[model samples]
Target chain A: MMPMKLEDLLRTKPVFVNVGVRSFGDSLREAGYQVIHVDWSPPAGGDQKMAELLDDLL
Target chain B: MTLKEKINAANEEALRRIVAANPVLVDVAPASEVVPGMRDKLILHSGPPVTWERMCGAQRGAAIGMCLFEGWAKDAASAERMLAQGEIAFEPNHHHATVGPMAGTITKNMWVWVVQNKAFGNRAQCRQVESFQQFGDYSKEALSGLQKWRDIWAPTLRAAVRKMDGVMLKPLIARALQMGDEMHNRVVASSSIFANAIAPILVDCGRSKEDVVATLYYIGNHPFLFLGLAMAAGKAAMDPARGIEASTVVTAMARNGTEFGIQVSGLDGEWFTAPSPRVKGLFLPGWKDADAGADMGDSAITETVGWGGAVIGGAPGILTFTGGTAEEALGFSREMRNISVGRSPDYLIPALNFEGAAVGIDIRKVMQTNTVPVIDTAIAHKEPGHSIIGGGIVRPPLECFKKALTRFGEKYKE
Candidate 1:
């Protein structure tokens, strides 16, 4: 299967999560890609997944 | 064997290889005259310095461009072929007691920054900086821009250099170091001083305003406008100290596209090397991870000889690209202080409360700490073709240091 292009990935997923600096995400959205930034440490990976409990959104 | 001994051997071997390669300085001409096998080669770049494996991206591209410029090859493909064929030589600037800016390339015919150690018969060379090749970007704009620099900017600079009684930029740089300007990212003070020194000569030379303006603008714009000067100064300092039997001080560090190399005081002019490490830093806005090239060039010799990234705290602005805060920069300076043989009374740092910049990196410290030297450098993605997209920090592999240390021990086994 072909990998999804960033544009395709973004069109389906209106929001995105960037773990590091928000600067990359901000620039991405400016290029018409919607992204949501999440600032979390390595230990918080589990909590982050739980926080993204968007069964309805999915 | 003691780690120091091993390091000395490595340094010796590295030096022997470089000297045996018989890399002679080419023409007394300027950068525009860069043909090939010139007596002087200028290196331009940032970081801990690199060898060939580390040479990548814009630097590699530029190396190819340099081959084209020198007529060594019809294009990059032929250049690579020549490099592989071993028909053409691959010598680092450090081997010649020189430094290069980003994607540093010194072909024959190009005028080089010629700084002979009047005290020791030793000499160093470096290439001129591009007029506007900041970010090491290899866009259409960047290539054309460099061409303009070669044709128009370089000749004018040559004329200006000729007019001036051979500008010795070290004193100016040393003074600037004392005055709030770090020799790396924050060279406002250095640039101003250089401009002041050269401006008078330029004005009196009776050149056209556009040429003069262009030259002045180029000099004033790059914070590292003093890179050539610093390489020359470092060469002066280290050349005098070379061939000290028990001394494990590094004399030079440089990279081509295939290896990272180092030369030590004890080793004289040998080049000990290991695979170069990939640089860690911010990438360009649009480029993907695959679009970058590996590390390339001889510019890092500046840091290996001291200055560039070694004294980062002296230049806080470097934090943005080198992947650190101002505090980290300061810490880097302090850390380097622990390893050096002495502080440079000449290159004083204002931020460290008038402390002298770290002068020499001791081989013992590298072996004990396993902390290979860290350098702030621009990042080129692993892919080829694209120019420099972003920059950050990187550390030379400890293996190189270990190898140097190990070799030093055997060579001087008493």
Candidate 2:
């Protein structure tokens, strides 16, 4: 369970890096914590076929 | 080299051409005389090649208006019949080294701003923006405005351009970005800069006081006066990037009210198209979203070369017309950077702490990030005989970029 490490992190303030969905970061900001939000979404608008095609080219 | 490495090399080369381009406003002249291959019976419309039967309502009305302008028909009914019967040849402005906004109808006798990319020695042209007929009003009043351009405005401006030996457009465009002009939907700063440079030349033109007064007054007050010239500059700058093997930079983006299309650098002489999408925009009084037409215009050329929506961070004032918050505008600029090859060396934006404008749309990054380019533009009424109703922001259909990527895979054997 990593009790030692989990207890140590709980003992201090935490800075967060949030990706995609912004609500998570906003919630943290509301709670008076530090958060960095990354504006992102699924590639090719989440079309599986298009995503595969893009991967092939890459 | 491997395919990935080869593609990177080609894209870098294409980006070099895009950033190195020096587009100069060389002249104002008739399309028949300046645009390559323009002919007496031909009318160039916006977007990709479309048949008369498939033409949208606004475009159809503009076609009839142009026919009347060319003296091919005496009335709208007869003009519509001629276009329907295919008696008059129709082609896209992009096919003729030209571009125009909205309905984008350019007849042989129409005057156009000519821009030459001094770096590559290739030129492009675009007709001046009309207040009404461009969006399909063909009333006697609308047609009279065309007569004014034909009879009065064009000749006076042409003389000034010749006397000045051509205006250097790049410096003005660079400065406009700092003054909050995206160079597409809003060009007030560029308009003023153009007027400031040409006012004295028009003064020494030795014309009648009445003539110079009318010309200067119109130029000074018209806010979008520089958009067509900037569009020609975009075309002139981007054309040289086309035909670079393995390059995935988008060379052109246009719409014809019915469909939206794009061209890639490696895929020369080809277009990827999808049905046109509606623009979410703020409308004029008594107008609603239902009254607006589908996205249309050759003005997306500005975004291709990274001037319009790509640099919106520097021009938050456009948000009022295009409908977005200043925060969103700044976000768009940052997002565009992810899709482009790099920032431009010439056009810099203050909002980003003086970073260069985003330059060179790479289709690969578009596929990678699933982000399409944004365009700030004016909106027209959907009906055949109405004029502009509003202004807004629009994006090309994702299908266009997806199809381009699929074709890229096949062409490069990736």
Candidate 3:
């Protein structure tokens, strides 16, 4: 049997949470959907050393 | 103890100090008299420390204007030579426990508002906001405008504040938040409240009648006057939270035209800096983003403590100035909510269903969520010698936050 929740999700509109590029959220909203922009960037802006340090933290 | 536990406990302590803070309008005095280590020949600019050669346009202009105001030089050319020759000393406002907006140029003789955190027993000072000088214009008219502030406006304000014997700021800022003041870019409510509350007291401040009238008019007409107080209050409140070991809570954020910088509670005096970002929003007529400078000001101190863009959801009134619909402004606040540790109980946001204003930005959350603090500030011209070109929104570079978090990890090695 297929997952019941997937069918429910498709039937009702899903809220999109766009992780970066805020304009994606704006575009989604303009296309008649609810969207939340995360205003994200690469972990540590793609700095290998800094990303390693961040990964080491709590 | 686990690293997570250490961060959690330390951040709790920082927020304790922040919420317990009671900043009062304590006094008004010249920078030399009150600013720690302020000297006759010294001028202070905003953000982390930056030197003359790297100085942005507005800041260079403001510094030259200050030199002229101090009578260190009779002409702009002379002042430029003296400043360049190291004949005069300048420093960042943050280094001296003070803050300012825009170019943030303040000098030895300029009068400063002193906000004392009554609970923390520390004081923070900032000078009032005037139009031309902060944007780096040093025309004779602009210089003369500052002269009038030194000669007339400052003295009247000083007398009135002294007579009031310490107006309480927590209530005013809290109330103004309710009245739709963003407490950074648009401070009409707080400025108006301050002027109205002081008008009657100025009657007893003992200046000549004509002087009092002119001073009241100045205060009433200027909407940005209270932006300086919010900066000083933020400084006063956040100072006691400094050096809370293991805390990832940001204690300060600021920008010079060249860079944006921040200090973490655990890091003490060290600043994590990144290149300043351009503002994205409405511009005054005949100007666009090209004419805008890199974001600059010491005013992000307000947002660090949870006001301005941190709670813009409740301040739709500023949307008229910064250009956005109310729901979009609320969306920005919801995004800010993702990075903050929690909401402040004392400062409430009605539009968010009377939720307390989001407070205590946590670096861990910022990194985990990949969100930086949202800033609402005015755009100064990239080159000096111009007035404000526009108002808009901005953010500190993510690189600054990443660098800060990396350093925090190094310092807290298990």
Among all candidates shown, the one with the greatest DockQ: 2
Lowest summed lDDT window (length 10), candidate 1 chain B:
B18-27
Q: What is the clash tally of candidate 2?
A: 0
Which pairs, if any, clash in model 2?
A: none
Quote the chain B TM-score of every prediction: 0.79, 0.98, 0.98
Flag regions of model 2 displaced more than 4 Å.
Answer: A1-17, A22-36
Compute the lDDT of residue B309 as modeled in candidate 2: 88
DockQ scores of all models, one per candidate: 0.01, 0.62, 0.40
Q: Which number leads on TM-score?
A: 2
Which portions of model 1 miss their true places by more than 4 Å?
A1-58, B1-28, B31-60, B71-89, B118-121, B131-143, B288-291
Model 3 residue B389 distance off true place after TM-score fit, in angstroms: 0.8
TM-score of each: 0.71, 0.95, 0.93
Report the CAPRI category for model 2.
medium
Q: What's the lDDT for residue B33 in model 3?
A: 90
Ranking by lDDT: 2, 3, 1
Query: Which DockQ value does candidate 3 get?
Result: 0.40
Residue A30 error, candidate 1, Å: 37
User: Candidate 2 chain B, which ten residues in sequence have the lowest lDDT sum?
Assistant: B145-154
After TM-score superposition, the amount by which residue B397's alpha carbon in candidate 2 deviates from its true location, in angstroms, is 1.0
Worst 10 residues of 3 chain A by lDDT: A44-53
